[model samples]
Target: MEDQPEHSVSNEKSTAVGERQLHRGDYGAETELQRHLSTRHVTMIALGSSIGMGLWLGSGKSLASGGPVGIFLGYILAGSMVWAVSHSIGELAVLYPLPSAFVQWTGKFVSPSAAFSLGWAYWFNYILTVANEIQVTSVVMGFWTDDLPNAAWITIFWAVVTLANVFGVKVFGEIEVVGASIKFGWIIVVIFSLIVTSAGGAPGHGPIGFRYWNSDPFTHGFKGFLSVMPTCIFAMAGSENCGLVAAETRNPRRSVPRAVGSIWLRLSLFYILGAMMVTINVDPHNKDLFGQSGTNASPFVIAYREARLPALAHMMNAVILISVVTTGTIYIYSGSRNILGLAHLGMAPKQFKHADDSGRPWPGLVLSIILGGGLAYLNVKNSSADVFSWLSNMTSLFTLFGWGMICLAHIRFRHAWHAQGRSDSDLPWKSWTYPYSAWWGLIWCMVLIVVEFYLAVWPLGLPPSAKNFFSNYVSVIAIVVLYLGARTYYRGPWWIKLTDIDLDANRRFYVDTEIEKVPEKGLRGKAEKVLGFLFN
Candidate 1:
């Protein structure tokens, strides 16, 4: 690809010379992205990204390795940690409405070293995520036919998502909204089915009633718990896509917070409780999670099969396919947004920041396609199981690392806010449990990282599995190299101090919207009145 003049450092030099005369609260007056996503769009996007193939398929591994207590406790703790991270991100996104969203907060509030590692690390995470999603989708495709090569299916889906992204975020948001709503409802159905069937309502099992938990509850105790943390973390990877999309969300103060808050409900109801079903139903020592039964390795599918519901099992497999494809689309959008963020922050060539009139960042989209599509060919030699394992380790490690950086950045932001003598009243939204919550979240992140490291290098102080060691720590190696390289080139401070933090550069204070008038008592009122009474 030929480099264009618009992307040159010379171009940045000329553009930097023009002074923008702006008053207070006008720092982010204009953004290249269109804020077309409504509250429903943002909310569903978050749910869609979070409640996908991870829960449907990956939880099998979580249950197999960690057992009942481990899966339950791990998700509970990780869920709380992610909630804290999202809350911190919500506060920052509302205050500074810009492209690249929270990744830029690391530069302003934490350190440029962090921004460099986190910004590209997150991009890499999503790039690999897109590839993983496609490979998983192809695994699901095998349930029907292996006539089309895995690469063929990967290319087909990749092209579909890229076309939607090119059309712009409006198309992307609409597609995700519809997909998320269906998957969200389906998760509720699966949960209800699991409870009912486990109680002997489905004919094959007579009140299994947490038998798996009572018999072998904690598999291999804590060491086993540590081993599965990466898989559990992988299942929760895309939750942060919400904050990244805040740049294109309408009324981010409301949309982003609503999206962030919903994560708790999603995690508690879907992930944590879903783990409960797997632990109660599927054997903790089950080998299916490693795809012994192919992509239908989902314990949920196994549960359905056990309950004399082969059709239901197939239906759930279809849902997993749908979920993986939807996640694939979302990750493409997320990965492109990260590159766009990097370019805007001057870490990438300026050309990547260029968006079409439709508000699509063209070059960033191209880069995402290249990374995702190029990685898809890995499926040709290695099976989806091998590919998923390798990708999960990196994605999980970097995702947790990204979460840690978010908490660190927010801690610094809050410190500076207080140090500057600013009132919390000036904020659009305030998270509960201030400094304590941030620290609580951060401590857990460190715990997971340490546990993962121990599980990889020494299982109960035993020798490390050379394969697990490298697979699990690849992301850590990448981040260290990236941080050191960036620190060497742009060395300044190990940490950005509160007093020196730039809080004004992107202080986007939105004008309050007029409230909509209430509808008169009539057909509309009758419909809502009956619906409301039934709902109440």
Candidate 2:
């Protein structure tokens, strides 16, 4: 599979864009994606992908481990790293805008083995995450009914999402937009209320100020801070999906950069400001409030409780449940697409290559649903409520691994581009601080992986309940084994041959540049451009 070439490059001429004509078969595919997704859909989808259960439930764990300062710094560091990775992906997405952006790019720019390993790794990661998200949804629902087994809710939710995807991609996009809108709305309300309450409003609690951090500035100290970095990084991990969906967006050349550029704003508003609000409003040392029985004591919830707004806590919980469901839907969609990409490339079973008349990969969607539902059921039976926690941590390792691979691939891609004498202007979106940003992301991911490995093994200051010190490392180990096995079987050396990397050579097969347009000037044109910016 690694050695197989998906397409052959020919010098025929076909298709015109405005005034320019593309070489015949510029993009590898014969069919073009319909531009059904608008800018709002794309932006919200990106936002939704990054701000799910992690921010709601996982933040408490990070705070418990690292305390306030730890959680704050971990997010800052990780957010910066993710920003770099996102930019790298954005650059590639704009240039190619293929269905399976990352996997396809890896196959073309690095080695087929690299692409195969990455595709499987990312697919497996999302599958596990979907299982985890469903489990979280069940747990949250249990707050209302403990008698109903989580597995039942898991199956129901999985079925609903499966049916949604089978209908068409547009359904998925619309659902994501609505889901994200709810979550984003809830966040805005929470943030606004927190600020208002902190400034001495509502009943009682006179100008709360930063009294929460007075006694224990750093709850767990340096050890705690180091421990929380992994989870913090996980929260910001999937923002690059904006680029992944670039192929489905209209005018990706402009849309992709706009999406990528939004990362900084999101980090500032969502991660940094959100974390700050939680830390300043809720004390990390509130042991009784955030202990084991209080697993659902998200820092956000804790803040509301502190302000004597118990009702808001319930509302937040409901919002969180919806967030989990929305996130699961997105995960399944992405996982199925990854599988479809693999099938198209001859790496996965051809059954996954089956697409409906509307271009939705029904076979892959069904497979993802069945697998996700089965995993959810098995996890419920074995681990019960703890399934989501376990799967979430395990998936974090793979997320880091995926980010690291992207950075490395971009580094190689830039080198190859320079070697081929291609200028940056020829690219749709260019990543700034070449090599530096990519290297920073790679290094941070490596560091976090090592630290996570140590935490999983030593346990050190961690709670004794944390099990299987090596479980989180399983994904990393699996990736290594696959790469080595593929390398040995292919009779290839450990080093990759850069020139042999296809890097979108097949993309020329389907890219219809004639349909693509350059932005126009004036108010009406600018308004259209602004609207176009939202889809991806």
Candidate 3:
């Protein structure tokens, strides 16, 4: 659905005003991006991005090491922290609705140097994520047959994703809507099927009611549980992408909050409960869960096979293949947008900022696809183990770093709001937890960083290796170098003062006033009523 103006000004005028406000600083004139994303688009994009390879494949790793109890608890802890971050971003996005979300906001509310560093680091993280997913696609395809080489599968999938993204935001939104629906529907089916099979309802299975947990709830021990935390965090890494797309969302004021609000449900149903079901259905010590079997070793697949449903197992693999491809597409979309945002901030070349008539940042998009797809070729050399491991380690750390910066930005934003004498009532959407929620997210991000570093130095099972340590902690070094280098070059304020923030810049004027909802009166009305919580 196209966004209708809530006030007298046309969409074009409102966009022009927003661009003018954003151009007030040294960043110069900002380009306007078309807001093509609808409520369903934003919501499904966030859902599709979050519920991908991490939950499908990485959960097997977590389950093997941490066991049933460890992963469950780890997900709880991580889910709480992620919700805090989501809420913080939702509030900020509703008010600011900037293209790059907190990456750019860090400059306005925190420090320009910080934004520069965070933007590049986070952009790199997405690029690696794209490659990682593509690599996994090879493994997923291998489940069927090795008729094609790994590189061939990689090339084919990469081409498909590039084409999908070439058509612009509407196509991206539609792809996500379809992909997320399939993923969501399959997960529900798998969860229910697991429950049934565990109850001896399947062809050849006896009741398996929490047998794994009863025998070995914590596989390795406390240390093993600690190892699961990072995986849990990675599972939900892209949850915040909803905020990044807010600027391109047709009605962010109404859609963004609803999308963010649903995150808690996504976490609860998808990860927490799904993890619980996996533990109940499959033993933690199941050797086929990981290792030599690869992505085909997902616990859900194992569960289906155990229930004597080989056909369904194959179907599940197909769904997972689609899920991985969709996620790679999202990472590419997000990476290109990040470049556009960097250009808007004058951190990247102006050429990268050029958007086609359809609002596609074609230059950045091509660069992102080339880099992401190019990196996937590392698998052909049989060196993906080393290359992708380093990439994984760096991306995971950057996820925490990005969240920390976002929380920090939200804190500064609240400070500016109060310092400027703006009432809480003026906020389009207020975070009920406010200071406490942002602090929770910020503190937990720091704690996870320390924990991840500790895990790197002395990994769960193996003796410490300098190589392993650096591989895990390398992103820290990268972030530091980027921050210091940008800090030196920009030579802006070391920190932005609360009163110095341009709070009014990029603020959506339409949201500040009340708008009436036009009630529908047919099948659409019933669907709207059913999904009412998805919009204001």
Candidate 4:
């Protein structure tokens, strides 16, 4: 890729502003992302990001905690929150498509310090996520090979992902597409089989319609449902990554809106329906089975085994492994890109701007691999998975924080648009219900954050478990300390002025006319169209 003028920063001003401003590199006129990320890749990324081992491994916990009713309602609540957040992100993405996306927008609407805190928090969250996924892959691998140490497996997996990333973004996207296809296909089969078996088509069982329900329909009650909200939110976390890639998308204006609009349907069909199938097939009260199975236990696997298809368990495990790897790879890719964006904005070291012939951020990718691998090694050395749990919980917090920032950014972006006397139609993508959707998403995120802190800090009369309490609270505390430390060093006041925010700097690279295609009529039309369909 030819290096553009906007990609280079001036060296003369580097020393004048001091290291902090120097680190906040220029928000260039152009971003160094490839347009190779097509609509299918983008959509598949969003799908794959949300549908991970979490669904397979974590769903049982959610079901056990909330029962059928809690599982259903918790997912619905979290899914709706994700939907609104996706829409809010879409609006900002259309208006100002940047690589950092929400973080950059937050900086523009809030403060540089706010952006700094939010950006690093998110980057750290993804790093921890990348580490957690590595451990998860190791755990899954150990199911087949008990001899190999998990640390060794994690190191090997990290190296493979790092190599894939170094090859280029296109290669990374392609691998993810293939990985996503396997996971998505497996889920479809599982869902179908579930429906068939529930209808009593199996030879021995007959129809098992709601049999598990009568056993313990409301097992966990309200608290159980609330308890599982963190995992549910984690599953739905990546629904908005589409907006993050808008700057690199062929037609972001059109594609992002289309992708955002589909969040509701996807969540309903993929998550809600999939969870319901598990609930119908497996009894949540079967603590004995769960205890024996542990993390290797997928309700779908259990159901398949019970239905005389024990081999399906192996297939599902393989698919889950692939899903974890894919998600881990994407997290590393995203984390590196976030670092590159930060580098470009002078928020990080300038070395991160080093891109190869394929425009891959080499330095950023290397750093992520090192960080991810190091974290994995640390977890193994500690002989405690509690660090992983704590990191995962903190990730949930940061993810919520990022979502809240997106809504706040959208609100400010709209106000700026109105202040400039631009009509809503003038924008490339418009969010329905205006400020209300944005406000609702923001409020919901704030509520989740508060609740997460509460759950982390106080037991609310639950058993006095040190592991449970610290695992929950440490993340929140760590993030606050990091944010405050960064702000203090920068000499920034707690409150940031909105006028100082640079909302429009990174938006100049977007080409609005590229994504004007209308929605296709039938299935054939939709199938025939490629990347453009994402926008439609």
- Candidate 1's C-alpha runs over 4 A off are 1-30, 292-296, 459-467, 512-536
lDDT of 1 by residue, 1-536 (tens): 24666568655544432111111222232557777776667777877786666677777766766778888887887788877887888788878767777677777777666787888999999888888887777777776788998888888877876776777888888788778867877878888998898888997778888788888877778877776777778888777778878888767876777787777767877788877887777886766665444444778888888888888888888888778878888888888778787776667787877777777877888888888878977988987776877898888889888888888888888889999999998887888767877888788888888777776687533567887688768888899999998777565557766776657777767656722232358864453343234222
Expressed as tens digits, the lDDT of each residue in 255-303 for candidate 4 is 6776776676568777898889988887786552222235446677777
Instruction: Determine the backbone clash count of candidate 3.
Output: 0
Which ranges in model 3 have alpha carbons more than 4 Å from their true place? 1-23, 26-32, 292-296, 383-389, 511-530, 533-536
Q: Show model 4 residue runs off by greater than 4 Å.
A: 1-29, 203-206, 287-295, 377-388, 459-462, 465-468, 489-504, 509-535
True lDDT of residue 421, candidate 3: 96
CA-lDDT, candidates in order: 0.76, 0.70, 0.81, 0.71
lDDT of 3 by residue, 1-536 (tens): 25665564554553343233234653322455677877767777766677777788778878988999999999898888888998899888887787677778887787777888899998998898899888777767777888998899999999989988998889988898789879877888888888899999999679999888889989989889988887788778898899888888766777788788778767877888888888998888777774424443778888888889999889988988888889999999999989888888878888988888898999889999999999888888864434544566678889999999999999988888999999998887887878888899999999988988998999977799998898789889899999998766656457776876677766767743544343478853554464565434
What's the ranking of the predictions by lDDT, best on top? 3, 1, 4, 2
Best by lDDT: 3
lDDT of 2 at 205: 70
> Model 2 Cα displacement at 133 (Å)?
0.9
Clashing pairs in 3: none
Candidate 2 positional error at 180, Å: 1.8
Best of the two (1, 2) by TM-score? 1
Q: Model 2 lDDT vs. the true structure?
A: 0.70
